[model samples]
Target: MGSTSARTETCKSTSEREIAALFDRWNQSLQTGDPRKVVANYADRSVLLPTVSNTPRLDAAQKLDYFQHFLENKPFGRIDSRTIEIGCTSAVDAGLYTFTFARTGAVVKARYTYTYKWDGSQWLITSHHSSAMPEK
Candidate 1:
């Protein structure tokens, strides 16, 4: 591979690594009930297609609005895993996650996938899809 291509691969891998870290960070932020911190890793135009809720937003502010609502219930979670697959400037991550609410003490375990794109310099999340596991 050319040096540029190699760099792109490195970038893609780095993004996948960061996605795992971001999940933990985001979950911690959610535990804290702070929307801004929770949404920090997402791109300005990111969309969260959660299998948990009905609210959908087009921008950060709108997304945060959804987070704010979620925070009202003191929602929190932990990401247990993350795996990445990259192609060109696109990357996809699939993993298992768990959530705990301070108020409800409910443990929400689920599977999640995040899609990101390299916007030339930085890796930004373009889409986030999450689905909850059936209660056992």
Candidate 2:
């Protein structure tokens, strides 16, 4: 006589719309004008390659510093176009976005990518890269 055991695996799935909404969450955080609120969207081990600065923000403090100055602009972001890719426990949303600074009435059109990971509880930005369009 032989005994066999069966293994059951559970998969977690996230929809494209859900992933897209994550950007809205982040953008709303920016509207708060609090760097800490914006930083809360990121994982502890994350990287931010921002649009306005050459420095690569690798840690919380660095990210906080960058956002402190950036938030001063009262930036509001809108996605121009985007593509979302879903993976197991991870997802990537990359696209073009435009930011309008309320303080200066300045608009910036940029190409951006946000890589997110499910940290067992919530999706957090693992890496965020944004660069201004070079043509103009």
Candidate 3:
């Protein structure tokens, strides 16, 4: 008989419905019109490639900078198409979305992809990439 040491690892799994719910929560956060609240959805080590901004936000301050101006438009986003992929402790939601800006009464269609990670307690956005539609 051989003696062996046993180790245990904790794994987290998320469902398709749950991933959609996470996007819902993120959309709801944007409705708050508070940049801080919007930033809360992201992890400290997160990246945001915003729709309107040319800068790639790599830190909280940069993300806050983008959201500060973005929230001013009072943008409300709705998913037009969604494809969700779930993995162990991570997920990606990629699709098209439309944003209606109340301040300017402008409707912008965009492509978006959000990657999230389960950080022990809750899901946080790890990477967000969004771009406006190029077609006229």
TM-score of each: 0.72, 0.92, 0.92
Put down candidate 2 lDDT per residue, 46-74, tens digits, no spaces. Answer: 99999999999999999999999999989
Candidate 1: stretches off by over 4 Å: 1-16
Model 1, span 4-121: residue lDDT tens: 6433244444645664655566666777668888777688878897756876666888778778877876876666877878777777878888877777787789888887777777
RMSD values for the candidates in order, in angstroms, are: 5.2, 3.5, 2.5
- The reply for model 2, stretches above 4 Å from the true place, is 1-10
In candidate 1, which residue pairs get closer than 3 Å at backbone N, Cα or C atoms, i.e. clash? 77-99
**TM value for model 1:** 0.72
Better of 1 and 3 by lDDT: 3
Off by over 4 Å in 3: 1-9
